[model samples]
Target: MVSSDHIGPNETGRIRATVKTDGKKGRILKTVQVETNDPVRPLVVLKLRANVIDAFHEKPLQPDAIFRSPCRKCHLDRGRDQMGAALFRADCIMCHMRGKSAPSISSLKKLSRERLKEAIEEGVPDSMMPGFSWRVGGPLTEAQIRSLLKYIKGR
Candidate 1:
């Protein structure tokens, strides 16, 4: 929430937010979008990061855990009906974007198409990357995977 809806020139205001960490662990990133009237930059994105430690502490969560319960509310349900770039932004970008645990788009673009496909379909072994294919206990369907592949490749 913002301290005020309006801020005069040369004035400052506070933007505060809260996050629920109940079933979440490890590094989590959340974004807040602020809309301004400035002609130069109308919208600003603020990133909030927190290392949520519950009983798990610093242990890595099972990749598939994101597909369950509370985590799925943000990670899975948001992208359920999305495809292509929209899907990436909703489901993948939070972790895969710059300065996160997952590989950024620049690095991912370097992989061969076949290798990238395999990575998305089968996921990296014993890593935080989970296979997105529904056949592998993930939420993505064959068509969604194909759409994501095309979107990533085109990036």
Candidate 2:
């Protein structure tokens, strides 16, 4: 909708319009036409294009990157293992939700710490899980991996 169809040059020579979109994902194209008093150029047209998508509230990390470098800056606190908890929430919760593909905390508690660390660092072969170490093309550093482990083990 245009604020006004007619605009005077002395007042405020501006063209303003607004568009509203629904909860649908798609491409949109619109052309707006304006008429002028000039004889040489009597009309002007503007085109607008937009792409809409429905996505998660928080964007996931890149497939090849475990975590973003910027996010690591603020996650330096080691007290209470908050960094580990944050990492798990950001990375693991997707596939390891309760009663989902991954086992529960109670089930994982039976495994030895070394075994759990091995699985997390190396990932199981032919599985969807990916190793989160930079040496293996993952986003986590050694310390971050340890933090994640501590968080998972509730230590």
**Per-candidate TM-score against the hidden true structure:** 0.64, 0.47
Q: In model 2, what is the error at residue 84, expressed in angstroms?
A: 0.8
CA lDDT, every model vs. true structure: 0.84, 0.62
Candidate 2 error regions (>4 Å): 1-82
The residue-by-residue lDDT of candidate 2 on 1-155, one tens digit each, is 55565777666555666556433347877778877786888998977778867442147544333233453322222222335777776566655668566766666667888988887777766555666666886566788788877877774
Highest TM-score: give the candidate number.
1
lDDT of 1 by residue, 63-126 (tens): 8788898678778888987898999888898788898888998888888889888888888997
Q: Report residue 155 deviation for candidate 2 (angstroms).
A: 5.8
Question: Which residue window of length 10 is worst by lDDT in model 1?
Answer: 52-61
Candidate 2 lDDT for residue 107: 65
Report the poorest 10 consecutive residues by lDDT, candidate 2.
Answer: 71-80
Report the Cα RMSD per candidate.
7.5, 12.3
